[model samples]
Target: MLDLLEADRAFVAENEAQILDLEAQITARQRWIDLLRDAQRAAKQRLSSYKYPVLTLPNEILGEIFMHFLPPYPDPPPLVGNLSPICLTHVCRRWRDVACKTPSLWRAIELHPSVHRLSNLGETLSLIAKWSARSGHSPLSIRMECRRQFDPISIFTSLIPHRARWEHLNLNFGSGSYIQTLDIDRPMPLLRSLTLTVWDAVGTPLPLLEVPLLRTVVINDQGSPSLVLPWSQLTSLTLRRTHPGACLSILREASQLLECRLHLWSQRTPLGGGAVVLPRLESLVFERDSEVCREFFESLVTPALRRLELPEAFLRPHDVETLKAYISKSGCTLQSLRVTALASLIQQILYRMAFRSIPTITFCE
Candidate 1:
């Protein structure tokens, strides 16, 4: 029995020695495997450097290139797809880091119902939230075009939180009801330009009183009476499809206007007030489907006016006399005059001959 036990013990010792030797081999092989991995990684990186030279450019240059990749400032790029800045993040880790770090690339946002599907509203809103966050604290240029079916408030809600940074805001809604819900009454110190267009009449007034930097304004049709702006600060103004009465009302406060364009639609309302003298007015354009009222042209007093454009009918009863009297009344040196004539060639020739003293005179039939 003792001899048998000794044989078994010898067998156990041999098995234990073989297992230790195999374990030692594994440890040494693992070290070799680790070294090979490091070598593979370094070789791959060197090969990648030669294959993709653009990756070798400094991040600053790359970031600058990204800036040009977008549309000019105040003009926003697409929200998604290849043309969008968001696509830059999908290329690789390096690019994602660079794009997210560049705040200007994400400063402007466009939420158009035509550009995005209604089903993706949630997704688009999420993307906008992320986009705005990436913009840091940069002043934002936001353009939102909403149709009747699409609730602008969903997208606008995301924007209201960032209103303080709003530099340029353009809101075009098919329904005026959307405008009433857009609680943009808060102070926006950086706001400079505003363009508002609404198809339906707005009952509520959209007050933008805190915009100290606002200089440009464009209101379309029914939106004219709905906005309460600091008109005295405006340098450029465009009113489309607005009545002459409304235009006169707005002009009363816009004493500093340098350029003005009015597309008159209705003249039923009387021009009850006296003349509005725009001391700094330089360019004036009046457009109407029909002839404008004589009083409409005569109501404006622009001493500094250099360029005047209007329909020949506005000077009815006596064209030459009215033109001469208007020039004398304004005391403005006319550099250029443009008239849309519907009268006979003889009448046009009369204007050309009578206004020979003017530098340039153009007639459009």
Candidate 2:
């Protein structure tokens, strides 16, 4: 009888422990349910409060807002207009209509031969044609960058019909031979800015580009023959990793240049050797190479110069002193000066300027 009673007690103890465990699990599950319910309610309320209102603005206003997001240049990256379709259109029906109608959003047409294969070239050209048609009479910007595998001559010729309507043109040839027989005789009268990157051999008697209102020109060359700029109304010129021969060609072409950025490589010779004078130059930036700075100062005869930037690595004590003395002697109309040099060179410049309180000089370390 005692054994039976002990066995019953043991069974009851086991049952009690299991009951307690089950109760604890039930409590935990109930707490989780309550928390989830509260979270769901809070999320719904937040969603109700923060949801985008149905836009009642006119189509014109909505179109203008969408246009603001469109890049000023047509040949922006392929992803430029993707956001409008993904996010802008999904906002509301009104936004969707506005986004679809705003032709400027689709106006920028980029032909990247690297991203598209030869089999896909037809499709790419078709897409460009569709976008150009959608742009209507509005001036379009065309960016054509091709890899060595793709024929740039064929691609350029295909887009020749729309050349007259182009306001901005950016041609980047990576690894392909330079365009030898390009006929840009028909004037791009509205072209305002041009950026060309050449990588292969460019032969003699360069292409003649007639961009009447051209303002900005950027030339980046890896191994191409020197480019010749024939623009007259150029206000800004940027040369990056180019040969001295190319640099001279640019300076010779852009007679009315106002802003100049020269990024020289160590291997190439210095530019600005002859009587190349920038009559209306306001800002000059010399990056990476100090030899260019020495050569620039030697050849510079700018009367309307206002700002000058020197490379930090090349800003030696003697160079800074020479610059200061030159500024004082030349009666330079400099208002803002930025010297990217060492602290010691800055200290030397400040020490020299102790006598005369001229324009404020900014040191960028």
Candidate 3:
């Protein structure tokens, strides 16, 4: 009986040992299974990130995408709107970091300061300062239009500090009060395009000879004599609300002009001078003055002229003959002609036949 009992005990002990060994093996396998599951989850996360590139795109790549979101540089987006770069800051934290660090995004600014509203001026100035700060050392394109009310000096004061970066600047004011406050006497190294317009002429002339890089200019009647431009260097010029004499005088100096647009204030061609010969002039647009622009038309000799726009009245008493003579004199192969028609059907037909050699001709009444 004792031997049988001892055998039973030995058998039980062996079975217990086997059970413990099995438990140890099971625990090891379970640990490996858990580790594999953790690794699989991490890999899945990586795959999802790859699928959505914005999630994993480096900040530099994201910044480039942000740049495409705004208008091209030198053309400003609104200071505050969906189109504004400021909208990018409202996104995730990472995106905000990327946008704030991109200088080009904040380089252009457009401001309209209403004199009627005294309240918004402060806010506008704040935004201008903010953009200036965010732009870093990048060149600036600034446009400001102030209507009716005087004194937008504060706005000018804000921008005067960054004059070195003025690339494409356009300033329009209701009166000339703002012109004196414009501290543009300092050199604008990067200034390429400039537009300055005001209603009443001020004694203070805006001498902009310091802008060596200036190529394009647009100014009004008040701006004509008041602003001294680097006329010879200009490639494109637009003069609005100017006298015939003044217009001719400017054209005489702008010898390098490839394109010119003149909106004459009167038909009186006061001075009898030689034709304002522009050898390189390619396009000429003469917006009708109060009277006929016949004399003005007779004044230009552009050999390189390809496009001409003027009133039919400007072609004068002998329209076809005048145009034929003008074309002959210019030695220009006019590719396009646009005429503001105020002529009878017979006259129009004759004009059409006369200019049939021109590749494109359009008439608008």
Candidate 4:
């Protein structure tokens, strides 16, 4: 044991010199690394004094980036100093200039009637006009939602001047806004999309039924007898929490619809027995499944139907058969079908339908 201990000590002494040499080399390399790190940080600091790489990007690229920052279509974007596109301006003078000159950046104007005080109506109008002017000749997308009534004279006057440029408009009128009536006298030659959620619609409907280029319409109401849309021209339509009968009535006129979404509340009366043939309809989305929904699908003669979605609803085997028969009668090439049910029995049963075009089927509970 004593001899073994002596041998271990000798081995340790033999390696001590080599260990010191390795430690010295490590220290030297660490010093070089520290020096390089300091130099790299200094270079970075020097480069920071110049414009950023993104800032050097061309104004057109910046404009495209700014557009991406906005919410996608059918959604209203915020017009604030802190939020995107708007905040891009407050970054620096160059950014402000580019953003102001980029007409597309200023195209989507959202008016939050709650933000502006009633006393500052004139100032608000002036500000809106200034904002509108920045858009130049570009088409406009305007969204307005307010709880209180501002002087319509000032508000509409500011907005009306830009009517010729209006391509998309979204209006959400809340309670006590005293905005019961809406009228757009000018022809919307460029209008393509419109969404309206008007409560207490008092006077006549908006005078926008005859827009030549209007293609998309989305409305949420029980049924707006006052409002009339150019249904034949629409390619996409959405109606939520509305009567199924009313929807069928609209579908009767919306023969050109390519996509339709009906989120109806339970109906007391069945749809007036009629068929509406939508030859171009490709996609249909229903919020729930019921007798009314079944009947609605039965009424549709959509030769182009490809996608059908019925979320959170019960569909029995007979109903699935009815659906399969409808598809067969329409001669549509079904690509996708989505239905939600707690039980898997119906999904299995639906597989028995010998559809000519086997679709990618989904069952969600």
**Winner by TM-score:** 3
CA lDDT of each candidate? 0.86, 0.66, 0.84, 0.73
In the range 99-164, model 4's lDDT, one tens digit per residue, is: 889877778787875653334666667768767888899888888775445754457557887788
Model 2 worst lDDT window (10 residues) = 77-86
Instruction: Rank by TM-score, highest first.
Output: 3, 1, 4, 2
Model 4's lDDT to the true fold? 0.73
Q: Per-residue lDDT tens digits of candidate 2, residues 1-365?
A: 99999999999999999999999999999999999999999999998778444365678877887777655555464622354322576777767767767777666677775553435556656666656665677777777877545566766777778777778888877543445555654578888887888766545635446777779888775522444456467899888886555565667667798999888654445454575567788888876453444544545566677887776544344665666665664456887666664466747466347524447567666
Off by over 4 Å in 3: 1-51, 114-119, 147-151, 267-269, 288-291, 342-348
Candidate 3 TM-score versus the reference = 0.81
lDDT of 1 at 258: 93
Q: Tell me which of candidates 3 and 4 scores higher on TM-score.
A: 3
TM-score of 1: 0.79
| lDDT for each residue of candidate 1 in 27-144, tens digit (9 for 90 to 100) | 9999999999999999998887674778888988898999999999999999876888988999999999999999999999988856755356778678888989999999999998
